[model samples]
Target: MSKPKDYTLLVIDDELQVRRFTEVSLSPHGYEVHSAESGREGIELGTKLNPDAIILDLGLPDMDGLDVLSSLKSWYQGPIIVLSVRDDEDSIVAALDSGAHDYIRKPFHLGELLARLRLALRNNQANQTSPVYTSGNLSVDLSSRRVTVGEREIKLTVTEFELLKVLIRHRGKVLTHNQILTEVWGPKSVEHIQYLRVYVGHLRQKLEADINKPRLILTEPGVGYRLQNLDLLKEGMTASEAALIAEKVD
Candidate 1:
């Protein structure tokens, strides 16, 4: 009849307000929270604390978030959710490709943030034994952590890769916006559905033959999305994206 114990988390953000707010926010959830003001300090603390997960701000006072991300990837082996206000495609792609487990845009809800954090922890543990994930034309070799589209390698940002993997793992099921957000983003953020729209837009743009009539990334209107069967592609000529890709054919 006792309350469940809280997990440990390391939060790395240069902004004092953000750091303090996050620490207080997570404290009630039974999480043993640690704070760092710099990427360097974060990495060192991450090694020492061995926390369940890490929340890292991309823009740091001492170093770039991406640079710190690279450093963290070099040593740490846990869930890392990249925090940033930058919503551009290039920045999101760069962070995910570098090894961030997930990403969070700033000005978010505390409850959603906690959800995202916990989901990251759960996924990190799940990936330890078996890493390969499959859905439609996409197959992610988790052990090798590689993603391929019909035998052709498709580069995905870390967050993209995670999103694809989760969607694949739960194919055919109707994952609500919040469900996808929680699963892909983390336990900390189950309600930031806008983030889902942006990331899903990116995934379809990258993976579908045609982004307009997305065959691979199927939308559920007001709900979440899904991966269509691979056969759907060969049977259809809808390649809005193929034309988009063709632009680079030269």
Candidate 2:
């Protein structure tokens, strides 16, 4: 296992206390923490450091957090988690749509923040390293275009598979409806959110053990959907090993 020091985290927040708290809390866990007070400075530091992950606040001094997120997403491919006091659903949806990997309301627990950070980093690495994704009883083999739920092979339509590919690629992260539509159907189809819903329902019926209560593909209320990241199966095996086993199984 790689140590946290192998990762560098950038925190973009105007609040001095938030910066200090994040630095003090994460530094001991082997992470290299850096802070920027304004959106411009954050963008500059982000470019200079090219950190593995970023903890961004929606309220920046020079510009709106959404604008900063837009700028970063244009160049940065790493995970960016929005940490802010904005609790409104609109703000959350906007952030997710703007390319945030996750959203955490203010007055958050350090443990939860750490867990989110870990997940974001893990998912990012997994996307780069593996063509297969597994969670719970579900396994998707992107290389072969195969999906299985336990012992049963599940067949999916081309559109359904494309949608599932998007979700699996960003497993554990919230994907806005617009993002999903744009990726799956195209930018012109972004407004067709109902199309996304129907396909998701089809996926649930095929993937979920109980369509009434989905454990894999989860709805993020008014935002979008997230693939639950249950990760590797069994003890002591890495995700790669599990993927290999899943691909080999009948």
Candidate 3:
């Protein structure tokens, strides 16, 4: 794909080599690139530059990368691709849940990274139109980051919101535990099935009219979970999540 001309990109990494490599690669391809050597500098540059997108490194010299991600997200809504050497699931999940749009492991291919950057930019532009997704009484305002059921607003933590967003984004589709984990939390967290169970239960208790009989989120036994029958009213939650919700109630 041809690169889009005049698009500004901010690369935030402590390593001089990574910063130089990104600048050299992206500059020739039509991106006006800027570099920052620390989390504080990155945040400041990002705030001042207001780039179209950002490439963030998780392992910063001064502060944790996740903290930078969170702080930047509070003000910057642009697509942020986390570029990091921390390939572990927990780190990836934390970054994603904190609002990183994409996570790319370090030692990445320039071609693949460029492709991801383009895709992120394209998606961000498409999403600006404001799409609202609904299932029964539950509604998710993707643009506003607001969720509600009937007349009541549902309050969710950042992680819970991201988790719910993933499920709602793929409503009516059964996403395996691994798929959902990778989307919301990151790749390494696929084995943390227990975390999924807990969050699903929390969602049920908040959204379902009757927690014991949830009408939205459905379980696929050992497979995964999905929001069932978006265009139609479903009867109840799947057994596992329902069971967990029941436990919460009791």
User: Best candidate, TM-score-wise?
Assistant: 2
Residue-level lDDT for 96 in candidate 3: 63
The alpha-carbon RMSD values of the candidates against the true structure, listed in the order shown, are 14.1, 6.5, 12.4
Q: What are the per-residue Cα lDDT tens digits for candidate 1 across 1-250?
A: 8466568888999889998998787788778889999989998898888888889898888889899889888988877787788877567656765767666678766655665565456545545545565546677786677878787998889898889877765533234566678777787887688888899889888777778877666665444564544532233323543333222111
TM-score ranking, best first: 2, 3, 1
Clashing pairs in 3: 93-185, 214-236, 214-237
TM-score of each candidate structure, all chains considered together: 0.54, 0.87, 0.56
lDDT (tens digit, per residue) of candidate 3 on 66-156: 9999999999978898989987766765676677766677787776577556646655654454478766777888778899988999998
Q: lDDT of each model, Cα atoms only?
A: 0.70, 0.86, 0.76
**Tens-digit lDDT track of model 2 for 1-250:** 7454868999999999999999999897768999999999999999999999999999987899999999999999999999999989899989998889999889877766776777778878888887878887788999899999899999999999999999988887889998999999999998899989999999999998889877678787788888866652233345554443223221
lDDT of 3: 0.76
lDDT of model 2 at position 197: 95
The positional error of residue 116 in candidate 2, measured at the CA in angstroms, is 0.9
- Provide the lDDT at 229 for model 3: 38
Which 10 consecutive positions of candidate 1 have the poorest summed lDDT?
241-250
Candidate achieving higher lDDT, 1 or 2: 2
Highest lDDT: give the candidate number.
2
- Comparing 1 with 2 on TM-score, the higher-scoring candidate is 2
